[model samples]
Target chain A: MDLTADMTNQPFPTQLFGDDAIDTAEEKAKPSSRQTVGDPFVENPRMICRDVYVYYAEKCAINNVSIDVGRNEVLAMIGPSGCGKSTFLRCLNRMNDTVGTCRVEGDIRLDDMNIYDPSVDVVPLRASVGMVFQKPNPFPKSIFDNVAYGPKIHGLVSNKTELAEIVETSLTKAGLWNEVKDRLHEPGTGLSGGQQQRLCIARAIAVSPEVILMDEPCSALDPIATAKVEELIAELREQFSIVIVTHAMQQAARVSQRTAYFHLGDLIEVGPTDRIFTNPRHQLTEDYITGRFG
Target chain B: MQNTPQQSPITLRINAGLKKRYNTEKRFKRMGISAIVIAMTFLVFLFGSIISNGYTAFQQTYIQLDVSFDQTFFTGENLAAANFPGLVKKTLYSMFPDVTSRNDKKLLTQLVSSNAAFRLMGMVTKDPKLIGTTQKIWVLADDDVDMLIKGHYDRNVAESNRRINDKQLAWIDALAANGKITKKFNTQFFTSGDSREPEQAGIWGATRGSIYTLFIALALSFPIGVAAAIYLEEFAPNNGWTDLIEININNLAAVPSIIFGLLGLAIFINFWGMPRSTPLVGGLVLTLVTLPTIIIAGRAALKSVPPSIREAALGIGASKIQMVTHHVLPLAMPGMLTGTIIGMARALGETAPLLMIGMIAFIVDIPGSVTDPATVLPVQIFLWADSPERAFTEKTSAAIIMLLAFLMLMNGLAVYFRNKFERKW
Candidate 1:
């Protein structure tokens, strides 16, 4: 996790690590850049990753990387496509277990519990830590049922009215209630792309997960819908910890408190959103942010 | 080559190649349309022939005779001894008193069906008062007489080649002129059981047997097929053994249906000791034949349900089984039922397999249970088709029509289910 420490200590194979060292005086002028060395470590991280490596067969999708998703904060993972941002985010909820060839190594813990522990039942783990996909995958169900699916499957509610209450609260939290209030019985798929994505957010929230993973949740939506989802994400951070994977650097800059830049399956730098954008310690992160090369 | 036409390839090609391409496209479209027309024409021809040949079987010929059942013949000792055929022959002879020679009398007796005497006997037994009185009763005619009445034999053809000879033909003409022979709607054909006498034969027995066979087939195959399909497509890992099983299922669907018959013959009959010719045995055999097709269709149906739906269900904390049962299975049900109908339709038309299982028997009584000795419609048609009798040809066609009608109904229900469960996403 200490980018500068590892860079200075490690001997060779600089090509795999992205940079040899961060000794430039101009890069050191920025104080927030120092967090990139040790832990970008938060006072209280809801979920912590330490030297995590993900492999699909023989190919390494995520190299030795470490980051933290802090409580009541949005940690946006910004990188080019296939840079292992989504892959890393999926590991938090153990969604990658569904992929037969995917293998994850090292510690990915929710609080004190190592989530990758075999003793952990993924069904309940997923209930507690939910995910929203990149595409607006609203189930082919009614709007109300789509939100109720999680709660019903987990047996969180006693009866229909209770489920209805949960659905209403979840949709309201997602800021989709007013637009869809009159047609809750209608199919979730009938909604516009933005509404459908918000419905998916509502579906995740209905389970009352402690942490929500969004994998480029607005990539499929229009700019207007993107702004709406961004606003929702900002509002949602009050109660639930969030880890968002976005290809749009501006989206990460706008919505995240802390941003981690991934380059070629490696976490190159991590710091506060403003500092990472303005004064990236690693040359790769700086070049990427400045559109020099992705 | 390009340098030679560098003046402009587009202009040079447009004048000739464009028209040629357009003409080729037009010709291809014409060929496609012609292909459809030819296919439709064959379909029409087949249906036309079957319908024309089969519709006449729905009607049967009858002879109205003034039968004097003489109550004296039914007295205590003679009640069991009284010869019904003798009484019927005597009654017909008295009416046609002009027939004097012994051979002529024999020819005259063959005019009415052998079942006619039994029919009269049953009527008299039901109502003894009719024995004391003479009543004009309509009785079944012989297969030859029925064929003659229906014009089954070509009148222009030589008498030696036809089923009805010159003497019998004259007798039929005389009877028709006298208003004694009548062609009426064949209600008995729908009500009675199979008979060696073609005119007396009906499909009721076969229909009941088919119902039992189909019920057993559906009951055994559906749950098993669907479950196997779900397991293979959803839960089973992508392993070599799974691949082998999948390949076997596809191959099983294409296997000759008769091979299933041989399996049933070897296993169900020889090894398992299942009683031969019962619907239970036939249904079990058909289930074997139908399983592969149903499984193939079921797997395809399950596969058609998008992976996103599975992911959506799993994302909601639904267990793997729960995900399949709650979403994937329901979405795939219409397709499954459609597949089942297609499989059943094939089973319905199947004759070779059932024949191997002894469903070609000349069963007389309607089957009361699946285990009872029985014959299905297709096997019944096969049996009738093999009979040398002239009238059975029509009965065979009629049975085919009924079988096809049942299949059409099942397919219609399948379409209804498909439409009902066809989801947009």
Candidate 2:
């Protein structure tokens, strides 16, 4: 394909690490021969992804990569731009179905059910695995309705009071109930940027999904908001499994238990966050963590 | 980032060019202002001419006369069939007993409108007690006499060119001397229907027809156009077939309105056998003409809705239809309503398509329903403009004023809906 030809024409970032690192990294890191180090599996996983590949038309956006999201655990995928971390994260909930030319191939299962099966409906699958986007995208509705929209559409509540209770619980879980309690009737878009992102998180959890996919959920917030969201992520890990794609390695180390590092659509390494950050195994992962190359 | 006072060569050159750039900007601003000024001038001139020419049509000339309803005519059961014109003529001749030539008598009778007799019949029928009394009443003056009284015709011009001859003018002057000839508010223009006589014509029938036609067109086109827009914009797959459909809709919007009229003529009038000149067929034809426009506009409105909202709804597990209805539709509704209203405005002012559907027929009765034969406002204006009578020129301009007012009203409603429903995201 034209994409592989283009990728070969561009200089690899690892090549800038000087003679010794380049000699060793190139010998082991041919595009077809690259392999993931450390364990990519978990016991009783919430979601099991095996040999997943994604394509956008003729471009292979996601090369063969495998990872697992354990139940009640936070899994963070950190990579540079154009590394396909977000693409892999989106594959977890089949949000890539919205893209007309996008194609995903592999076995992806939520619990025992294969999510990629043709017979599986995405509506219920999405309800079971909700997502939060990079930018704060709250519905242009009241703050209360933003959280209630999911449960209402999924028919999780039978009465107004029950729906209101769900909204309050979701907001409380997202750590946004206090600041937005007085203005629950106001438009969600009227909130601060960080508050809006939290409202989106609330909206996602309102459906009671077992796993939540967050694509750079705090990337658009300020430092304080980012800290708050990182705190919320840690707190949320006790209930729902999470798969977050972030550019910030510090955020991944701070919030995630297991960290996966992607380089050019290839999963380079997977291990405990402390081991990956302090003592990485793969040469590319070491170069990335040492700030030699992104 | 600090500015240095010691100028470099580049700074010196830039300072030299600054005056030129400022002068160019000043010229551009002046040109823009002048463009606006020119447009405003033309608009003011247009309104000024229409108002000046059409204002006189609202007040009609009347000639007061004493008519003795005669016991012979009153004895008959059909009071509408009485010779009320002869009674008015006898009263005219009694005022001037010496002028007794057949030609002069005919000219004297021409001073009052031919509709004056019917006006007298209507008054007597409504009040039966006035039949035997010689009551003084103001009757409508003829169109020519009305023009003369309203100064529409030059009195110093040659008598051959004048609509009212010297003989008729002399009789009008005599009546004026006796305080019998005066102008009154033209209630006939609003109360009655169309007539061959320019002085008797009214726009109420055509206005009602326009209302009915626009109503049917809006009711049919708005829903279908919006639905088609939603399907094409949201649900349809991105393929060559959808692209072709989008292209066809845009092309249809540019098709000449007359082609739609011809299609209406063949399908609605010939095949369907609907009434030829009724508001229903005209409205259907107008719907065909406006549907493409409404669809294009509605699609644009839907496109203007931010895609982030759609993604947000979908992320929450709402189905495609639910996402569109709950978030995207509300966001796009104001734009869609505005587009529909503007399309209706264009439909209201359209005359070519209606002409092909036989809506240009000389309909004189107010339409009672959508199926009744009628002519819309523009068609009425077209008909009046084609008439050779001098008074119809003013009537045509008056109808144009009414049409402009109606168009303004629809546009105002569009703006109101747009502002009322516009939500910030």
Candidate 3:
């Protein structure tokens, strides 16, 4: 097979082709300097990822990238498919460890703790850094138990009343308590798609995590549910640091204070959401934000 | 629209094949329907033959005779050793006063089951006040007489070929004339154990043996099979060692059942010195036969649980063990139970393996526990089928019907449990 022909046929940015794919002397002379253009750091950061790389067996899924999650702020990561945004989100709590072939290297810290340290346990790490998936997933259990699962497993509450209180507060915070209060005993899976996603958010909040990672949480929801979840994200930003990966640039602009753009496993740009959307510095970021190419 | 001078070749070819296509479709449907009809016909024929041959075994022949339990012989304290058979003989003689030849008298005595004397002994032993009373009692008739009364034997062939001679038939007809012979529901068939006399035989022993053996097999195999399945599916790494183990497990499911019996004989009997011909040994052998099936089914059940549920649990702070036990296992339980029940049903009908473990013993007494020397239903059916007695032929089919009923009950339970526990999502 002609590897260069296949590479050019792919829709990926030209930087992903490596030095060998540059056939012309002029293109080889001026190599693609794959670099981030805007600031990727933040003040009062709750979590920091530095030089992180992820590989699935022989293939590099996430190239070396660094970014910070500010305290009490929603940080949106927008990228096209296969851009390593979700992979980066999963790396926050080491959820990628569940995939047997996946390998993550470099430093990622939550507060003062190195999450990937040998002495650290994933159970507690995951409890402190909770996640919501692309598709809504609720346990095959009552709505009350679905929210209370994390607190119960983590031994956050000792009594039934305390557990119920935690479940109530979590659901209320997720903006679903009013709708589901009368039917707490019904199965969570029986709820509508938006309600199930909110329930998953409630479950994450019940653990009282320092940061919440959402990987396209509204992708499976309808427009109305998406609006509701975006509103919930805005409300959630007052307490926990939120790192959300989204396919919708409008969603990223609407729900987040800061946005980071990733392309072909590279973080191309990061800045204030308005600045990234209105005045992008990187050409690839501008091209993606303007819909010239994904 | 303009019409072409000649039809397009594709349209012409399609139009030509339309009739043939419809004909093929109709022929296929007819063949499928006929296949099902033929299968149903054979099934109906089989059931008809079994029911016709075995239904008579459910009722038995009885003869009423006047017996005067004389105090001279029956003094209640010595009832156990009394000559009840002699008294029965005397009763027969008084009925046939003209027949004085010893051979004729003996032949007359053959009309009733020898167990009838034991029945009289039991009645007298229970009630001593009947000692000098001439009471009319209905007693069980011999199996040969039962066969004749049920019309299993043709009376027109010849005197030499018939099980009941002309004299016995004449006496039976004479007794019938006086309302002394009748057929009653054979409660003994359900209440008693195996006997040398077919009239006294019952299935209660083999049923209990089957229950005990299956109980042991299920109690041991279900948990072990499920546990092994969980470990191999969830905990074991995807490596060559586990791959080989998986291949071997699948291969073991296809191994002949009698091979498991030989393994049980080698491992549990000769090696472990467990008693042979007991439900315990039989159960252990059956467990070996069913383990692979249960494991395969359990793995399939575990595999069917969507991976999203597992990730959801782990995405929260639940440990791996908690994720599996709290979420995945409950979802997979209905399928696992279905597999276990199917395996148990197969174990219920298994005889060749138990035969290897000596469960084919002719055990006459009802087993009270798993360790007792016992035989299961299929083994009992097999033994009855091997017997030369004509009465045993009906017993074999009856035993088969009982086995089939048990299998249906187990499969029905499987369906009920699946419907009850299965969750949507």
Q: Kindly list the per-residue Cα lDDT of model 3 for residues B258-372, writing each as its tens digit.
A: 9999999999999999999999999888888899999999999999998889989999989999998999999999989988998999999998999889999888999999999
Q: Output the chain A TM-score of model 1.
A: 0.88
> Per-residue lDDT for B265 in model 1?
90
When just chain B is superposed on the true chain B, each candidate scores a TM-score of 0.92, 0.95, 0.94
Q: Evaluate residue A55 in candidate 3 and report its C-alpha lDDT on the 0 to 100 scale.
A: 96
Residue A51, candidate 1: how far off, in angstroms? 1.4
Better of 1 and 3 by TM-score: 3
lDDT of 2 at A179: 93
Estimate every model's Cα lDDT from 0 to 1.
0.86, 0.88, 0.89
Interface RMSD of each: 1.1, 0.8, 0.9
- Measured against the true two-chain complex, the DockQ scores of the candidates, in the order shown, are 0.60, 0.63, 0.63
Highest lDDT model number? 3
Model 2 has a clash total of 0
Per-model chain A TM = 0.88, 0.89, 0.89
Model 3 clash pairs? none
Clashing pairs in 1: A2-A37
Candidate 2 residues lying further than 4 Å off, grouped into runs, are A1-33, B1-5, B94-99
Q: After superposition, how far is residue A116 of candidate 2 from its true place, in Å?
A: 1.6
- Give the number of the best model, judged by TM-score: 2
